[model samples]
Target: MLGPVTTSDPLLTDRTPLPDGLDARLRDHLTFLIEVDKLKTVLRASPLAAADRRENDAEHSWHLALMVMVLAEYADEPIDVGHTIKLVVVHDLVEIYAGDTPIYDTEAGVTQVEREEAAAERLFGLLPADAGVALRALWDEFEARETPEARFAKAMDRLQPLLLNWMAQGGTWRTPGVTADDVRARKAVIGEASKALWDAGRHLIDEGERRGWARQV
Candidate 1:
């Protein structure tokens, strides 16, 4: 049982004093719980998966972090790669509550902003106030796609599945009845951050068409 916490509480450090107290750390823990649970549920939900499975949020975050490392050089604007990585990794923690909504699911439209906004408030608000605010900012930045860092992070998010789809020989594209043109239309957004990667992505999609792995939907 968590009992009353006094100045002598093990969680308290005498060397460091701050106005925020027990409530703050408890909030942080709640945030952690919400995010971790979200990670588990999002794992298998990839749009490119043949099985229509979702990737757990944690795995997806790691994947995006690695992409940030590899594609940082291709960004069109100035960006701190590490910060971009942080933005992508933690961006979807709220989706644990909101759930993964494939962009193509226009009929179901699971990706509504209201649901996500509510999820963000509940999930991110569970953290220490400062941390909650910071994480919420990162999540909002990724959603806004306005800042250089956010643009690059979103670009990576869009490109990764395309690459996976191509490499896996029409993993989700074939099953979802997605076409080369659709892929191009979707990924074109990456150009906002990195022209080089955008061109490369185009070339790859073109090649897939030539190879009969993709066609007009």
Candidate 2:
């Protein structure tokens, strides 16, 4: 049997000095990692498929990453799956700062863009200059939905919660005054990346309505 492997703490131990700029870069990177740990504390409106409680932003991003890996083939246009995964992962890190704005909440939607833009600046600025610019660009690309990868990533982001809600027996679908039409309108972005995914999502919405899990308007 192999014994447990032990590693030294690089920060605690005296070591050969890093090149001038590298030390500060490592510190900034570590700080950003510690800060993003807060994302696990940020609750979302959607519940887990099996668990009773709502899922957190970190869990949501992980799910989106998995969705991209599993469903990238269905994308409307050819996409770089690796790039799409990166997009999904970085996409919601801002929710750590801006907080999640539920799609069905019209009032919150009004300020969503403003809040998230500020969050992107503050959160990504935690990284070293080159990394900050690169990650921030990925976040911006995900938001724009102009590139094929961005469109597919956005599709996964929209689809994950919908699947969870259906699995949770109408999770957010049961929100007061949220009808089937409302869900269709909000989730239609799924079609921009893949008609097939939107078709499946629409089927769920229609079925949820028939089963009284969703309101029909």
Candidate 3:
């Protein structure tokens, strides 16, 4: 079972000393950095593509950033890859405090928005005002999914786990009550950003169903 969610390091709280000359902005930035390091401890439902253990939120965000970089070309509309990377990176930082709400977990999904909104306020507020607002805006943009960059970033967010699940030979698709049709319905957002990726992901889902890795409806 997972332990309690840790937003900050106990060791760092006691050991780290503020430099006398440091400005408030830099100090808050450093503090925020230390807090976010705990994101590495927040595990996701998805397993690593090459490992036996589950992947953590930090690893998931890093992978999504890379996906944005490599897969931006496939986006239905042109996107600023750099901005999209920022969106993906900021998108999940709330999980540091809110904890990961697995996409397929309907029970957990009930309060997901409330939990994440509160977490976003607490986590991003650790930064200096300007930086905090900027990062929070990026998070909001990602959630709204209105901009082209946000849409593409969200696509990467959805696609990453699908790829991992396929590699894991059903990953979350094997969850009880989950079916290939359900996956297609949930992941159809990929087509909103990239038809090519959605096509590929659909093929994986269909094949997984045929192989009995995922349930067929």
Candidate 4:
């Protein structure tokens, strides 16, 4: 009989050989799908010009990871910033499959959960077992919003749209009919996760209204 493999041997690691078909196929499909998302840029106004630049799904994940790096101190509670960042980074992998839906679009937002759930099942399922399970769990945590990590991650997601709209002089709000009050009501949940960011957002929304930048809800 062959001798038992050594526990500390690097070769003993759980990697499986890359096969030629389905075992390797879904990951490629996922990659291509996510790439499409990055190419699907948001349409903005004026100088914002939507950049004609689509931020790929990977870039979106990386951007949120960057936010977690820089804004973690502002979190309402102490957090494992690394873990928090990881959660945010992977939170949108599902967007690759479901496509990015703007929160302000009420009807689009309604189907988000279902779409994302389908996405989660498909995308995470692409990976080999262990990694797939781990990624799915992080994705699930964000969806459930039942943990501190999830709460902060979700807050970051909401905050991103607010920042984009504000930077573009109310890109989302500038739909010629989007009101300021609507922005507040839409973004109020920011407080539930991070009061600090919420307060800042309120100030921005208030000033946005005063400056006639964003319409009031």
Report the Cα lDDT for residue 25, model 1: 81
Q: What is the descending lDDT order?
A: 3, 2, 1, 4
TM-score of 4: 0.75
TM-score rank order? 3, 2, 1, 4
Clashing pairs in 4: 38-55, 38-56, 179-215, 179-216, 180-215, 180-216, 180-217, 181-216, 181-217, 182-217
Q: For candidate 4, write residues 86-152 as lDDT tens digits.
A: 8987787666556666656666767777777876776666566787788889988888888777888
RMSD of each: 8.8, 9.1, 2.5, 11.3
lDDT of 4 at 66: 85
Q: What are the runs in model 1 whose C-alpha is more than 4 Å off?
A: 1-27, 30-37, 47-54, 175-177
Poorest 10 consecutive residues of model 4 by lDDT? 4-13
lDDT of 3: 0.88
Global fold similarity of model 2 (TM-score): 0.89
Between prediction 2 and prediction 3, the one with superior TM-score is: 3
Model number with the top TM-score: 3
- Model 4 lDDT, full chain set: 0.68
On TM-score, the stronger of 1 and 3 is 3
Query: Which pairs, if any, clash in model 3?
Result: none
Which window of ten consecutive residues has the lowest lDDT sum in model 1?
A: 1-10
Backbone clash count, each prediction separately: 14, 0, 0, 10
> What lDDT is obtained when candidate 1 is compared to the true structure?
0.73
Total backbone clashes of candidate 2, pairs 3 or more residues apart or in separate chains = 0
